[model samples]
Target: YMQKVAVINSLEEDMKALPDEALAAKTSEFRGRLQKGESLDDILPEAFAVVREASRRVLNMRHYDVQLIGGMVLHVGAVAEMQTGEGKTLVATLPAYLNALEGKGVHVVTVNDYLAKRDCEWMGKLYQFLGVSVAVIQEGFSQKRKRAAFNADITYLTANSLGFTFLQDTSTVDRKDDLVRLAITRPFNYAIVDEADSLLIDDCRNPLIISDEPDTGATERFLLAHKVKTERVLRLGHYVIDRKLHRISLTRDGMLRGRPPNINDLWEAAVPMGPYIITALRARELHRRDVNYIVREGEVKIVNTSTGRIMPTSRWTDDLHQAIEAQEYPEVEIKGRTKVSSSITFQTLFKYYSKLSGMTGTAITEEEEFHEVYGLSVTAVPTHKPRRRIDHEPRVFLTENHMLRTLRLLLTKARSQLRPVLIGTASVADSEYAAANLRAWGIQHQMLNARPQYIRREAKIIAQAGVPGLITIATNMAGRGTDIILGGNPKGLAQLALENTVLPAMAAEGLHQQLVSSLPLAQKSWPKFAQLFPRLKAVVDAKLGAHDTSEGPDVKDAGGLLVLVLSMQESERVAKQLRGRAGRQGDPGETFTLVDLNDPLVEAAGLTSGMEAARPFLQSARRYSCLPELSSLTQDAVERTSGM
Candidate 1:
């Protein structure tokens, strides 16, 4: 890797001396060489050098030595476990550009639509400057647009979107348009899956399904079962719940107890009631609003547990969807009553790719699975600088109130130091809970979650999360694909200022001024808006031109962004991701985990017994100033015993 980096660096000066047009012509030159039977590896150094120079000229960014190593790993079809804040997004451009030289389509798979769009637009500048055609596939795109996008040299899309498109194409028997057929016929040559751990491991249990015809009389059965479970009183021993496996089953006595009172034929009705009753029980016990799913526009939307983003088009299988609907809004009509027509697991879907590579900060833990299942090796790329993040010992609290108290104190201290704070919660409800407490304490903060209102402003909120003395509460959505600079994101702030202040004022001066003047912000600033607009525009432009190095002296002096984990996630990788948010790219930062004894993970992992066993020791150690060591010991014990 070092030798390759040296070779690439040796050619950098020559590439830099080329004019913009000549730099871009290198793409055509590389393609010509490929057509003459030259292998990609033979021209790898020059290709990487060309990309690095193009990036520096177009995006004002250059790839580091480690990032070049990461690109090489991905080009050879392996997983690159690069740490957060190491510019993984920029690293991807290397292999993506090199592979696109062959004219075989390169697909960059993201975890969500927001990232797909963001990466496409942000990196499209560099790719286009190099004369490489880049496009993005998003929801609501027409077939013709999709065909054009798929035909481009490079495309950005979510893994779910790609899988569903493949499923739709496979199920299409009679095509009416050439565009649809062409789009469906495109080959999956090379795929780069971002957030590899979340897609390949955390979400591997659920398969992507396309539903077909609705089941007859299934809605009524679901409603009846939900009514019996909620309205009727039942004994505690009626049903059994396995939290580990997320399964629910009813005993013989529970079956008798769940039946309708007016049903006279016991044996005849009981046979049909078993499935519905069990499904309803599972929905009630396992599924939760604001956690597993959320109600939007009178529909139940499934939330990806790992990423904390709403899966708008995804639905629960079996009768689980109907049961949840019946449980949430019993009076409303139950929709999405359909059966599975075709399905494909992510493992099976990615196997169709001729070359598969991935990048994530937490793939080392799943190294064995990656090699055994996908035949991919995991390589950990060294960071450009030594990591300076300080990880404090985990703190355990016996009560939620005590935990909140400590959190309040920490926030106060962070505010005093003028440090930015990022609080990670386990779910939307937890985020709101933290927000409510922050409000009570009179602390100004931003909240990011799966809620519809927050989803649209996700990019804006995350962009300014690192501003001095600001606190941001987020779920798993902020864990991946986010870069929180130590000071602030100049470009994002400038964009927001333009959109909120400048654009509306400019639009208001036209014939539609009445419509624009009615807005609250525009109305308040309209008196001197014209005179102030120019100054605001100048500032916005100046900020936009400045690069984000995240080296604010005051911010660094305050110890960078402080990450507080309010609860332990199901996967330790997620907790690591949250911690990884701070100390990015060798920045100074600190992270501490405060776990409540009653946290869902605690109960789910069966750690309540262990906590009880160590409770006395923990309390005694707290008085002696040995709490940190004791807490670390307890945490290690739990991790070892639970196999997390």
Candidate 2:
């Protein structure tokens, strides 16, 4: 890696010698060489150096030596496990530019539409500066727009969008007009999957299905039971829950209890309501509101457990979604129609790409899975700076309420010091619940979860989370390509200023002037702020703030950013990703895990009996025991017993 960085660096001086106009010519030269059948490897150093220079000029950000190495790894088709805040988005430019020279399309896949648009626009400047055409594909994009995006030199989009697009292209008839409408004319030459582990492994079990018709009969099965309150049915002790597999069934005695008392006549009137009742029971017990899903606008949206984000296009198989919808709102109409015309897992879908590489903060924990499943090797790229985030040992509680109380206390203390706090819950409901408790305590906070239409503001919420004294509640915090800077993001502020304003430079200039006049101190604090204001650089740079420019030290003095894990996720990689939000790029931060016996992780682990056996080694009480060693212990037990 050092040698590669050194080689790339060696060409920096030569690239710097070229004038602004010559830089564009250099890109055409690279393309010409590629047309003549020159390998990308032969021009790797020069191409990377060119991108590095372009980034410095266009975005005013220089690529670190480690970032160059990371880019090289991806270009060679390997997963680079760079730590959080190491600038993965910028690193992609090197490879993205190098490969685009081939005139073949390069797709940069992120976890969501927010990242897709944000990265495309944020990094698009550098690519455009280097003479590469860039386009973004979001979830609701029209076919014409999608075709345009797919034809670009470098396209940015979510993995799900890419998969659906690929499926659409494949299923369409191979004709000229059909090809234009279905798009994806180019072959799957290369793909860089951001947050690889979460997309490739954690979500591999659930296949993406394209259905034509729903099963109307399945909806009728749950009708008899749906009329009766789900809470009442759950009150009976007839169901047995296999928490490990997330499956539930009726106990023999409960089965003998026969049809529910209030709903017995309704059950007899229907054609075998037993299975539907069982399904409803499973939805009530296993699928939780806010955790497994959220009731948004009176509809049930399945939450991706791995990412703690809503899978808008995903629906539960076996009529579970309708069952959940019926349970949530008995009066609301339930639409149940299902015929799966096509389906494929990430494991199967990504195989079509000629080259697959990925980058994430927590890929090493699932290194084996990456290699075995995707044929992608993991390379642990050294961070640009040593990580300084302090991760405290787990604080295990006997019950969830106790943990919530402790969390409230922690937030109160952190806010008093003006430190930013980001609480990462395992699901949408958990985040909302935590936010509610904080609100009850009179603490102000913003929440980032997978709610309907929440994707639009997700980037802004995450970007502002690092402001001093700000407390933000989020789900998973995995595969969110946006970086949480220790201090506030100045560029984001500039972008926000341009959001609602007119496109003309004069209008943007007027808004920028208004913004700077209101916050004159921003100029000194953010050296790049003048870039947003254009020709007003000289006037803005003359004035200085009352205090020092950077907010990093002030945040550090107040304890930097604090990450609170309200619940444990199933994957250690995800937990690591959450903790990674802090101490990024050597920034001072702290993380703590406050878990309880009621958490899905603890319940899934089946560790209560194990806790009893290991009581002598734990901090015990009469009612419950503290498994401070919960993570590794529970993971081991779950793997042994459940093979999950």
Q: How high is the lDDT of residue 576 in model 2? A: 81
Top candidate on lDDT is 1
lDDT minimum window of 10 residues, candidate 1: 621-630
lDDT, candidate 2, 257-342, per-residue tens: 54655455324555666767777777777887877887766667788777777888888987787888778666455777678777
**What are the Cα lDDT values of the candidates?**
0.85, 0.77
Give the per-residue lDDT of model 1 (tens digit) for 1-644: 88999999999999999999999999999999999999999999999999999999989999999999999999999999999999988999999999999988999999988999989988999999999999999998876788789889999999888888887776664344444464646678999999998887777667889887766566777788888888765556998888778788777788778877676533476457767778888888888888898888888889887788998988888878888988987444587478778889899999999999999999999999999989999999999999999998788677687788889999999999989999999898889988999999999999999999999999899888888888999998989999998777877877677677656766767734664467557645755664766766576766655424433557888999999999877777888889999999999999999877787766655667766787777666645223444566557654653434
Separate clash counts for every candidate:
0, 7
Q: Tell me each candidate's RMSD, in Å, in order.
A: 4.5, 5.3
Q: Runs in model 2 with CA error above 4 Å?
A: 174-177, 215-218, 227-237, 258-272, 494-550, 607-643
